[model samples]
Target: MSFPRSATRSALALAGAGVLVLAWGGSAVAAQQGSTTVEPAGAAFSATLDGEATFETGPITVTCAVSASDPGDGNNLVPDEPDNHNPEGAVGGPINAPNFDDCEADVPLVDVEVEVADAVWDMSMQDGESAVGTMHVPAAGIVVTTSGVASCTATVSPDADVDIEGTWTNGDPVSSLAFDTTAPIEVEGGVGCPDDTEAGFTAAYEVENADDADTPITVGP
Candidate 1:
């Protein structure tokens, strides 16, 4: 199925708003039984659950970033857009230009799917406890479009979740990570990402030097 940029942006924006609320001492909900959490880890990603299991929809952040270094900078490259037959949308066609001259140009990164366990009342951690939710990623990476802001989506039940995306320049760095909450959501049974995975939860990102000419992308927590 195709992803709706507006819908995803709304969902993620709402979630990110919830995170801000909690950060500012606002109340947030947790699932009664199942819950899931997702976060970024540098270039890799990870997820977890508490009570029941959940599935990820994959990263779905729509990127609108093109670099001056990118051969397609002036050509135009749109990512995750069905209309754009070429995902990289570089210039001169692949035959004329085989590789992305600005392959490292800062692009958006989003996780479309995240699987978690069903939330259970008595079998899981007490409500509002850290155990009830999972910590996904500490930070994420982002690409700025001609427009200044970027957005993404993340879903979580009874569990509280946060995922970050960073934006940086060669000298100065600034980052943003959209958040999501599936609180007050009901799960069939109580399950989450397995315990083994929980211990190794990761926080990945697609790093970019927004102001640099030859910036190489890096991924990490």
Candidate 2:
């Protein structure tokens, strides 16, 4: 679904608004109820994400291929702890490339990767329903780098949520993850854009299994 350019910009600006809350305030801790085998050490579990995503600057209409990897312990569905200030909620390693373009163009705007530090999601589950929660990256946490047409770098502070209703299963069998939020975020600094510009960006991620292997860990029923 395409969003109007005006709305897209508004959402993006709001996406990073909560960097302070995430950094100082604490998040709800997830209760643990089950046990699952952890992934092997040094093993990187990843998923292939292909979906329609819109950014504040422009429309990402291309069917881009995105990948997220977790180098830490295997996925922890019911994280022993789900607080942003703690380690429990910090599960998924980091999403390497959240947005990219394979199509050709004069400017060839592509290769937009947002590096999330110690990325993690707080998930809640229900029967026959996809899990939902917040995806947090700490203070001064996100760095967005773009290549091709115009090269630029943006350092962002973001606090976003997993858009529950949009979560669903893809060809990967297991359900995919989707997140969105429009909080007041901060753009610490950036290149290419005007100085002192508090550029806002609404971010969404649709992650699916990139391989046949079992999901690093399981969540939900």
Instruction: Give the candidate number with the greatest lDDT.
Output: 2
Instruction: Tell me the deviation in Å of residue 86 in model 2.
Output: 17
Instruction: Estimate the TM-score for candidate 2.
Output: 0.41
* Tens-digit lDDT string for candidate 1 (1-221): 11111111211111121110001001233333322211111111111111211111222122212211121222112112232122221111110111101111112332222222222111001122222222221121111111112222222222443321112111112221111322222112112211111111111122233334243322111
Error of 1 at 68 (Å): 20
TM-score of 1: 0.17
Count of clashing residue pairs in every prediction: 62, 13
Off by over 4 Å in 2: 1-46, 52-54, 58-64, 71-106, 109-115, 118-130, 145-152, 158-172, 180-221
**Residue-wise lDDT of candidate 2 within 106-204, one digit each (tens)?**
123244554454444323322233333334434434454444433444554444432222232332334454533232334332333322223222223
Q: Each model's TM-score?
A: 0.17, 0.41
lDDT of each: 0.19, 0.32
Clashes of 2: 13
